[model samples]
Target: MDAVAARSGVHRTTVYRRWGDVGGLLADVLDAASDDDWQPPDTGSLEGDLAALNQEIQTAMAAQPPIMAALIAASFRSEKAADAQQRLWEDRYARCEIVVSRAVRRGDIPPRTDARRLLIAATAPLYHQLVLLRTPHDPQLPGHAARTAVLAAAAGAFAEPEPPSADDT
Candidate 1:
């Protein structure tokens, strides 16, 4: 709080009064991010769109000071921050669902595709490499992961499984 106040040129007391604590402050920051009008890239094709989105995620994960990583870690320690972070994640996933929807409309992937699963498969590689393994950045990673996911999705790997028919029981 002191550092934030100093950086923002606000008094420490004022910052404390406004946010109450670090968890509150983190939650507010995450909520503000969720309120942004950011949308996934629309590149006409599912592979292109997923590649572009992966690039964005890679850049964010590799940014200096690693604010995204910090927030993710901090969320684990604070209930408020965790809730806010989950909201932010849900908001992003919901927004990105359009990519899958667009692909379905264009006949690029099967109907009733599991958008969330496909998206996570496409984006998880970057997170695993950069955030988990802390591996050096590879320029080919974004496109490679995107291509793999697109292929899997097109093969109906992410299609929603049909429920059992009445006769099965």
Candidate 2:
């Protein structure tokens, strides 16, 4: 708390009052960290967008591995951290959803495609390398992640389940 207070030039009491504890502080930090130079790209194709997003992820992970690592670790044990992490991801997925919806409209991918799932699958590898394996970052990972998602979508991997018919209910 002192470190955060010193860095932000705020009093420790104010920080504690606002955040209540380290979990809240961590949550706030993680939420703020979500802001970056990347926006989901519109390259006239789903593949391009995913690739762009992946590249951005790789760049961010490389630049702030420790912050990412700390957030991921805290998420497992803190409700505040977990909610913040989930919200951050939800916001990211919402942006990526635009690209998926565009692809659906263009007939490039199937209708009712699960955009959130697709985005998660696409970036899973980079997160694995960053938080779990703790391995060196790879710049090409974004392109590969995008390609894999495109392929999976083409194969109907992220297709949404059909809603129940009226008679079935």
Candidate 3:
């Protein structure tokens, strides 16, 4: 709090009164981020769109000072921050669902494809390498992961399971 106030040129008491604590501050920060109008890229093809999105994720995750990583770590320690982060993720996922919808419309993937699963698969490699294992950035990672996920998704890997038929019962 003190550091934030000092950095922002606000008084410590004012900052404390406004945000209450670190958790509240982090929550507000996350909430503010969620309020942005961020949309996934539409490159006319599923592979191109997924690759573009993965590239964006890689760039953000690889940024110096690693703000996204710090926010994710802090969310684990703060309920408010965790909730806010969840909301942020939900918002982002909802926005990105349009990508999957477009793919289905274009006959690139199955109709019942699970957008969230497909997106996670496409982007998880970047998070695993940069955030979890802390591996050095690989320039080819984004496109490779995106291509792999596109293949899997097109093969029905992320398709929703069909309801059991009455005859099965």
Candidate 4:
């Protein structure tokens, strides 16, 4: 209560009066802490596609583990953190859904493509190294490894089918 009031330059009584208690203030802040960067590359080539998307995902998470970690720790004590985290994760994956759907419509990706898995596959090796395996999230290593794994998985996986000309099927 005191900490929240101090941070916000408000009286503790004011915060308590508005939110009801210290837990309420914590819950609101946790709900509001978001680390989202919603932009995907539209490079003409799939290789560019893999690189751009993974970079956004991998770098953003690595750069802000503290907020995520803090929220997770607080979630053990507050439902607000859990609800907010779930919502944020869904929104992040929704961006992947858009990428996959657009690629399928344009014949740039296979009809049976799994955008969610594809996004994860691109990131797995990097995370295995930097997180699971406890190696540093070496900017160079993750960037290179992510691009390579995704492109390798995608090679011949989704070649564009021959399109008919205006005159022919």
Q: Using TM-score as the measure, which candidate wins? A: 1
Highest lDDT among the candidates is held by which one? 1
- lDDT string for model 1 (1-169, tens) is 6767988999999999999877788899989888888999998899999999999998888886677887778788888988888898889989999999999999999988889999999999888898789889899999999999999999999997885456842
Error of 4 at 23 (Å): 8.5
Task: Give the per-residue lDDT digits (tens) of candidate 3, residues 1-169.
Answer: 6767987998999998998877798899888888777789999998999889888988887776666777788788889888888898888878999999999899999987888999889888988888889888788998999999999998999998985456842
Query: Which stretches in model 2 have alpha-carbon errors above 4 Å?
Result: 1-3, 10-14, 29-39, 161-169
- For candidate 2, give the lDDT of residue 106: 94
Q: After superposition, how far is residue 47 of candidate 4 from its true place, in Å?
A: 3.7
lDDT of each: 0.89, 0.81, 0.86, 0.60
Ranking by TM-score: 1, 3, 2, 4
| Candidate 4 or 3, higher lDDT | 3
TM-score of 1: 0.88
Tell me how far the alpha carbon of residue 141 in candidate 2 is from the true structure, in angstroms, after superposition.
0.9
Error of 4 at 123 (Å): 3.2
Task: Report the error of model 1 at residue 36, Å.
Answer: 1.6
